[model samples]
Structures are given as structure tokens and as C-alpha cells.
Target: MRRRFCRPPRLDLPSLFPEGSGEALPAVHKVASLGTPRRVLALLFPRLPVERLRHPGPLAIWAAQGSRRIVLSLSPEAEAAGLEPGQALADAQAILPDIILVPEDPAADVALLDRLALWALRFTPLVGVVGANGLLLDITGVEHLFGGEAALREAVLDRLARMGLSAVAAVAGHAGTALALVRTGWNGLVPTGEEEAAVAPLPLAALNLEPTLMGVLHGLGLRDIGSVAAQPRPGLVRRFGPALARALDEALGRAARPITPIRPPPDMAAAHDFADPVVTREGIEAALDALLVDLCRALREAGRGARRMLLRAHRVDGDVQEIAIGTGLASRDPKHITRLFHEKLERLEPDCGFERIVLEAPRTDPLTGVQEGLGTTGRTERREELAQLLDRLAQRVPVWRLAPRASHWPERAMARVSAFGTVEVPDGWAPRPRPVRLLRRPPILQVMAQVPDGPPFRLRLGRIWHRVLRAEEAERIEPEWWRDTPDRLPRDYYQVELDSGARLWVCRAGPMGPDARWVLHGHLP
Candidate 1:
């Protein structure tokens, strides 16, 4: 039996930052001096779902879990009325019967989180999402842009407050230490090399341990981070395994974990903040030109060219419109890149005018200076011009090139691939001549032939009968054994010339018998 499979759907998360120091890491280091201690910020939204609704009265969000409904989040008023998350809904209502209840929307909450992460780009480009309702940012050398570390923390909280969100932010030398401090309602900066002292007094829950492991720790009377750290490493590992010790080490900055940002930082970037919001296309075009000049100059200085460029327009109403373009070849020409983005400028909607515009190239390749022939247009100049033309046409339509694939099956010998990507052809492999055009789906044909595997003498197409004048020797093609099934069979192909001098490509599927099938596979020119 032949088995069929369906292809999986693709995940669309272009904003997801790649793990480790992709191409963006080197640029981040260039902004600050080397050997600088990492400064991380953990921003938490305790009542994210409730705050999203903006309900002034007491409210609680609940969801169905198993056979009963439980509270998931609570507003400040609801919290003051003796309600809490994970509490039974029935019990919560029994305490405050007038409290408003709304169903939980995890998807909406997540979407809002992603939008907030995008908004955070104004503060620093390195923004990462922490679990469900929190964010992590790396502000190692970016604090000076907003005065200092303390001012930056306040600025983040103050801006989120203006947007009607309840945010608690904490900064520390390590990511884990910052997150632990934020959960405890501590909103201050922990100096470098003091992560151990900062997280020592926090509760065991701050470590975010598994419930089972937490239970064992509580049973053993280890209830605080300080107590857990006081124990010897080997003894703790023997009793509670390595996870306990590892978590402690991470919290104390003895170990480190890199933050996976919501968007990959760019290789080179430039931004312009408008004193007054600009609403006209002319203003936007002028700003974009200035930005391109700065970005291209940076690229030239680095001896590199951008392959992918992204433009972000931050509107006054907090919405961001992004336009992206890719080139078939690396380029740093401001005029050329501007032309590519010209067609896409209308896609941005200036709801209340754009407050800031940023341009960055996330993907780049090393490109040395190219010298063209002295007087006339040279091959090198023509090649670069061709790539630019292809890039423009591709913006409006799909463009690709066909490459040869390594397969014996006629239908699987060719593939569509990227125009700029490298193509590999198998070595020392040659195929027999085929038709100029192969049918996408071969149709069955009625034929009359000699007995015991002889070539067909005549074949019928619709109501016309064509007598075969000559038949070439059969070329047998076997199915690829790895993909073979019980129903598949070998094929014998022949190029037969008819009386009218028309050559047809036909194939016989299966062995010689009354059940044998004949298919007109292609038309020969």
C-alpha cells in the first residue's frame, strides 16, 4: 500500500531572535567598551490580562481547568477584596459576589506582549520576552542614552504607565537576579558582583522551581534563597539533584544565560526622532533618504553590503509599521536601496503621524570595492545592474531560477530555487534525451501492439488513429527502491515516429500483460 502524508504548516515568527550571537552580536559590542559588565532589566506585568481590559472596578479573570473553574488574574481592587490567582472561582465569588468576572484570553494577552516588545525598541534594540507576562532587556551600555541606569528604569515604568499599563521593572547585573528581584516588588539597581547579595533574601518561589522540587525543599525546611545557598553543593545535589544547585547558581550570577530577543538586532542601524510628528509623504521621503545615507556610509566603512533591510516607522499612537526588502546581491548604494523602498512606502499608515523612523540591515555580507572598466560599461557593472533590476521586479512578483535535481525519475529531476542561491549538480551523471515539454499529469492512451512485449504499431488519440512508422529501442527506468510501494512499477519509454512525421513520448507501466497501462508522458518537438 502507498502511504500519503500532509505537509506541516509554517510558523510565521520573523520577530523571533536567534539564539546566541548571530550576526547582530558584534554590532552590540561596538557601542560599548569591552569587559563591561552586563546590565539586565526584568519588567513584569502582574495583572497583564486585567490591565489590558482597563476595568476600573474590581475584576477577576478565570478559565476552565479540568472539571472546575479557577481564577487566573485579579485587579488591584479584586486583590484587596481577598481574591487571588489559582483560588477557586466559587470561593472567590463567595468572598466578593459583586466582583466582575471575565473569561481569560491567553492569545490576546500574548499578542499584547509582542506589541509591547516592539514598543520597547525605542529604549534599546535588545528586548526579549520572559515567559508569559514579563520582558528582559540588555542595557549594558545603553543607559547613557537616557541619562543613567536608574533614569532608564524609571523611564520604562513611566512610559508604560502613560500607556495605561501596570509595570514593575528591576535592573541587576544578571538576568536571573533581575527577574527574582522584580517579582519581590523591588525596583532598584543591583550593582555588579552583588547579584549573590541581592537575591539572597528573596523567597524560594523567586527561583521558579518546579512544584515537586519546591515541595521537597519546603519539607526539608529550606524556605529562602539564603538558606538554600547556605547548604553544601554535594549534599544539595545528592538530596534534590543538580537542578536545585544550578538554579541557585543562575540566580547568584555564578552561571549565565543569554536573553533571546523578540527581534534579531541589526548589523548596522540609524534612527531619526522627529521634533514634531510628520504626516506628509515628502517629509517621510526626506527622512528616509537621510537615514539611508547614514546607514550606507556605515556599511561602506565596515567593507560590507546589506542583503536584507528593514524599516520601522513608530507612530505617535504607539503602532509600528514595518517594511522589509531583500536583494539578489549585497549592496550599499543609498539611491538603489531608496528606489527599492519607494514602492513599499505607501504600505505604512501614518495614523497620527510618525514620531520616529529607523532603518537597519539585519543580514549583510563582506563586499570589497569593485573596480569597473575605465571608460565603458563593463561585465561587472552589468552584473550589479542586473541584480538591482531583479530585486525591483521581485518586490511585485515571485522570481526564481530552475536548478537540476539528482533524480532518475523524469518528474523529479528539476526543482525551483532561489535566484541568488548556489546550485549543486551531481557529478558524472547523465540522463537520456527527454521531451521538450513534460506533461504535469500524464494522460492514458489506447494502443495496439504485438504480443510478448513488442512495440506498439498504432495508437488512438481521441477519434484519430496514427500508425507508427518506426519505434526506437525501449529505455527501462526503475522506481527508486527507497520510495517503492507494492502498487508502483517500472516503466519502459520509447520515442515512436508516426506516419505524419510526429514523434510522441510514450511509456508502458508494469510488465507485459492485458493489465499493462500506456501513458502519453510528453510531446517531443
Candidate 2:
């Protein structure tokens, strides 16, 4: 009987932004940000254009509008030559004759921002894109995971710098506060309720206002957020509009906003924390046993099975060891899944004692019921045992694949697949008396025969000759004519005993014609 496995559901992840957005993305207005523990972090990428340059040397990137070209970013050498952002291209060229200028690519920038946001998920699950040049993360209750807020901040900044990004990171109780403070060019944790004072000195342009609105604010001498907030609420609303007031209120922690993370949260997860770290394979297996129990229970209750799952081992010293497993079919069988994990764990390197182990099944699918019979159940159980053994051994050694197909040619009789996938033998209907071990390719040998189609009397293979004590009748196996690479001959296979009592399976490539070739194909032990 053939075995059946379940398949998982599909998912399609989207890109960052649609094309044609040349300038900075407008500040995102939150719709309904989660009201979790307010720890929001804003990560600013100040030298994005300069860092994204394909080559190392000094370079400047600019944005062009017809005949008008303005500098978007400048390298250190260009800066030394008095070329700054917002300078006209004509003036910049006159100042620095040797600088290379690249055009701005909004689509590429958005894609890079999307990838960076995905990378930032290593720190927090609540990462959101901030405008075009920044990312917002809600570290919240997870700060202690990496040794509190300060350590996590340092780790984030250090990693960003190592990735060649010049970034500014600020954490606060509100997303808006973190957004404003990161632009203030400081890297520290601002305590809750200090958002107003923290951002009081930043220029009003930091509000990211429309150019006309910024000019209006400048005309009214409202040069900073502190001065703008000090004005009468109605006057600011009536003159500058509600967007400014809302932005100011959000900046000051007066309004709540929702941050949309790049991807949706994981669907199912099971984790365990140990008081004492685990160091041995036996301990890891025991923990995995308990975790699989919990995970299988959850999947059973939901009527779903995991198609892909990741096991993460968080060591006490801040290093994480992870192993992932995937199946073409969904499975919620704890014993089967645990066996797979055990097979993989043999090669997993753990640098330190692991204090926590978490298993996340990010993808799952429905598993409908299957009927079982007494005789069928017995056969299925045996097949399952055979499958488990094959799976375990395949990890250590390469195994040939034999699928459900039939052919007369010994070498091309069955399908072969990779060692990692399922091992299947074609129907248990192979012809009797065939050699148990067949060579990959039959080797031609010199043979002496008494008659045209008779068995071999003597075989010469390289420097050794084997005298046949007994020879059996030739078994001719024919080839199929419909194959793409059709075999034009029939094989005359024979079983013979040599003078030294060794048994051999030899064949003639075709009928004993004038040009027939004798080949040694297998040995019987």
C-alpha cells in the first residue's frame, strides 16, 4: 500500500513600497498600534545613500528633476571639497571636479529598507518602517531577553555599525517619542514621560512638515517643537492644521499610534526554560521529548500539522543554536518528528549550556483523518519502522532511491533520488533469481564460450581469469521501445560458479552475434 502525507498551506510575502516614490516617505500615521508595554525603538540610517554605493571610493548620489539636479548625499571627500546635501549639481561639479555622482534609486532604497527591517527582527518582533530612512522596534517586555534595555541597545548599534550602517537608535515608551528622539542624533534610552523634554530642542523641521508649512512655521518664528507646542492649541490647529497637532501630540506621548510590523506574527510556538542549563545529548533529548509533547498537543487541538519548524536553543551566554526541519508533507506525529530532530541534533554544535529551547512552527496545514484496518495497520506500522530506519541512516550515509516503477533493464529498472528525501521501493514484484548487488555500469570482459548463445566457460577481467565450474542457462532481459534513450539490445544474464567457488552474474550486451560484448554486472556473496 502507498503512504499518504498531508501538504501545507501557502503564503505570499509582499514587497516594501510601490514604485515612483522618489522623495522621502511621508511619516507613517499609526492607525491602532498595539497597547503593549510601550518600549519603542527608532533606528535611523543617516548615510544610507553613501553606504549603498556599489564601489568603495569617494562618491556622491543626487536626485534629478529635468535640468535641476540636487545632491542627496556626499562622501567624506566630497564633504571636504565643500559639497553638501541639497547643493545644486552644477555648483557641486564646479567645486569638486573629480567626484563620481550616482542617481538616486527609490525602489532599490525601499527594497534595502525592507531587507534591513527583516534583519532587525532578530532583536524584536515588532519592527516597523519609519519614514524612508528609519525603522521602529517595540522591544517592550522582551528587553530582559538580551540583558535589559541598555545591553540590547548596545547590541543593536554595534551590529548595525558592523553591517556598515551609520545609525541612530533611541528607545522610549511611545513609538512617536522614539521616532522624534532618534532624529535628534542621540543614542540612549529616554525614560517614559521625558519625550517632551528629550525632543524640545530639535528643530521644527524634524516634524517632517510640508515645505510650505515649514516656511509658514519659520515665518511665525516657531523654530522648535517646544515653541510650537507652547502655542494655543486652537491657533496651531486652525493655522497649521490637525496633522501638525496630531504629530506634535504623538511626539509628546499624548496620542496613541499603532506600528505595523513588516510581517505578521508567528502562528504557533512552544518554549521551555530550565532553571539549570542542559549540557548533554540525553538532556537535550529529554527536553525535546517534553517540547514535542506540548507542540503535538497544540497541533492536534488545532487539527493542523507542521510543514516546517525551527528549534532554537538559547544558551546562557547570549549565543543561539538553531536547527530547522521541513517535510514535503505536514506531520504532527511527535515520535516521527522527534526522531527527525534527534537525527539532526547529532551534528548540532552547542558552545555553552542551553537554558532555554523554543520550537516554532511558522507553517502548518490541515490534516484530515485517515481510515485504518487491522491488517493494513500492521503492514503500515512495519513500513513506518522501515521508513524511520532509512531516514536515520540516510543522514549518515547516502542511500539510493527506488520508486514505484518497473523496467527489465537491471540498471534502469527503478527511479533514483537524493538521500535526504523519502526512500521508496517499487512494487515488491522484482523478478526472482536476479543479483542482489548490481554494478552501476556493467564492465566489458573477454569470455570463451562453447556455442553461439551458451554460457561462458572462462572470463578474463583485467589480469585475472575465472574458470567456470558450473554455468546456468542465459536469462535474456529485453528493453522497452518507448523510452527516450531506447536500448537497442537484449541482455543475456547468466549465473556461474568460478573455480574458487565464487558466484558471478555476467551478461552479453546483445544476442551472441558477431559484435556481441560480454559484461560483468554483479557479484553474489
Which prediction has the highest TM-score against the true structure?
A: 1
Give per-residue CA lDDT, model 1, range 181-274, as digits (tens): 8777778999898899889989998888899988988998989999999999899999888988888988889887568878767776777667
* lDDT digits (tens) for residues 1-525 of candidate 2: 011111111111211110111223222111122454567878988778787664565688999877899999887778887888899988988888888989898888887788778666555445789788899876665565466678778877876676667788888888788888777677898887788898778787667778899888899898999999999999879877899999898888888667887755445655555667788898888878877777777777778878777777766554566787765456787887886787788755566687667666778889656332323476756765665566556546665665545666777665666533665556664656767768888788889887869998998877898899999898877767777356577778889999988888888977676688888899976
TM-score of each: 0.86, 0.53
Looking at model 2, which ten-residue stretch has the lowest summed lDDT? 1-10
TM-score, candidate number 2: 0.53
Model 2 error, position 361 (Å): 2.6
Against the true structure, candidate 1 reaches a TM-score of 0.86
